[model samples]
Target: MTVIDNTHQRLLPAPAADVGRLLDRIGRPGDPLWPSPTWQPMRLDRPLSVGATGGHGPVRYHVSDYRPGRLVEFTFDPRIGLTGTHTFEVIDHGDDACVLRHRLVATPSAHMRPLWPALIGPCHDTVLEHLLDNAEHAVTGTVTDPVRYPWQARLDVRLFSVQVNATSVPQNALLLEAALPPAAGPRSDLADAYAARVPPGVTTDPQAWADAIFGNPPPAVTALFRLRNALVTPFGIERGDRSAFDTISRTDRELLLGTDAGHLDFRASILVEPDDDGVTVTLSTHAVAHHRTGRLYLALVRLFHPPVVRAMLRRAAAAAVRPRPVTPPGLPTTTPLR
Candidate 1:
């Protein structure tokens, strides 16, 4: 038998079950190590597909052991360059929190382990940050930025944790789409393509842009649009800016680079509304689902969800309309010296 091991720990302000769900998100569904979208209702014993999205190379996963509120272990193809089994565990602290741990028994091929220090090292840190932030958000109402953590570790196993804010869902389609990666295209080409779909004048003003994207959304929607675009076009106010942008609300709209880790579908919507507050705009931030034209047509529901887009529009409108502090009158006009 092969032996490999490593570990990290995080103290979260959440119960074991909630912590377990947060851990599940660490390795995306259909990740090379865990191939499939569906998590088993009971312990996973046989091989299974962890997710259904396309773009994943062929791989197999087997869930070997599970203990409610405690531990889960699984094995899968590590790809040719990587090989391993993964374990996710939770240790109760006898309070409102628990310690979450992840361990991987991996052996990299000749080229991978050496290069991993530089390549995977940084991303592993990012993964940990993401886990903690996601956990805090899951447990609390505030959204914490994932860039705060600075600890780094190298191990045959990976571990991450965070205090999650409790979130509820009513089976809306938008959340699923938000979980996907973004589409890809040349910056100019993508902007041009999206611009073509954007009606004139609307892209000029942040408020108008919101109106154009959402069907007369609220002022908050306008603010959200402006914020999201601001992130994309930090310097230039061009509608064709190509920078990748992300929206992280319960419902979100994002323009992602294709080179990102996961596969994505492309979808969008534009709407306009008129009111005293200004035109409210709503935009769809959905990617086409990896599945369509299959025997399971119900799967299409999973493909094109847009609720998050709506929610983002609402928030943007609120942020857009928030009162800005007025600039005090400038000092008396200065006379020009001859």
Candidate 2:
């Protein structure tokens, strides 16, 4: 059995009430304190009053107490095992300054004991710091030293972060004539659309979404690119025509890219559609095999392409929202919680 008392606090250059006001919106639409997109937004079944039930990510808890503009406490569900409670409190510093704090006191269950230190603990500590960073920035407009998780913590966070599943591409996303279909035919030998919702914690603008989706090539992608070059060079085929993520066109709301390789012409469509909540970014792949080699390549890649595309989209969404100290030329590096 292991019991832990953990706490994180930040002094902000705003009145205590001002900082405390953020506590009231903890699980609300415009949460200013809980770092999100990078982390799950805290959600309650109801409002933030006592008895409101919910938790962020996989954590489950119910509000045991609430004090508007001062403090709030959440009691972890006993089913999950809890000792004390998790709380957010505000303390007065001066008329123009205050302190905001989050504390968790818990005794890990036998199942969680080992996992907590290795996985949960670091992520928890980092998330708390990120929350406090958000608090400081919300009240003070800047975060000089934002929380940065070590590689292990970052990996744990990604492995445990919100999961957005892939789905059939929305018709709206496919409507971008410039992004899909064969230039000469209604479709191609390999025309498929897979999509995933852009996370709420990321910007809804199509251009920003495009950058998130294609800017960083995941290691898997880069490795495959190298392997592809090696496989194609032996046959005197132009292997890097796609250059991994080639862009044919870009606009404020959509992007078109792909390649006309030696044996196949492949085009991909990444579409961003904004709605009330956030946006959905759809990735659609189209390929026309010009020869048996192209057909064979498609047949082999198809088995893994769906998962690969889904992973690429999921990775991009996570990258767009990783917490960092806010330094601005435009918006804060993080998208505002919606």
Whose TM-score is greatest here? 2
Candidate 2 off by > 4 Å? 162-166, 176-187, 193-199, 212-215, 226-239, 242-254, 259-263, 273-280, 291-293, 303-311, 327-338
TM-score of each: 0.37, 0.80
lDDT for each candidate structure: 0.38, 0.72
For model 1, give the RMSD to the true fold: 20.1
Q: Can you write out model 1's per-residue Cα lDDT over 1-338, one digit (the tens) per residue?
A: 33345554556667887776555543343222221111111122222334312212222445656665477665655554557766678888677777766676767777667665765555444444444444444565333233332334222111211011112221233433454445432211111111111111122243344333344444554565566456534423233222223222232222222112112233343333333212324343333323322213224323322333434443444333322211223322211111
**Model 1 weakest lDDT span, ten residues long:** 157-166
lDDT of residue 64 for candidate 1? 58
Candidate 1: regions farther than 4 A off: 1-4, 21-62, 140-338
Point out the worst 10-residue segment of candidate 2 by lDDT.
329-338
Compared to the true structure, candidate 2 yields what TM-score? 0.80
lDDT at position 73, candidate 1: 65
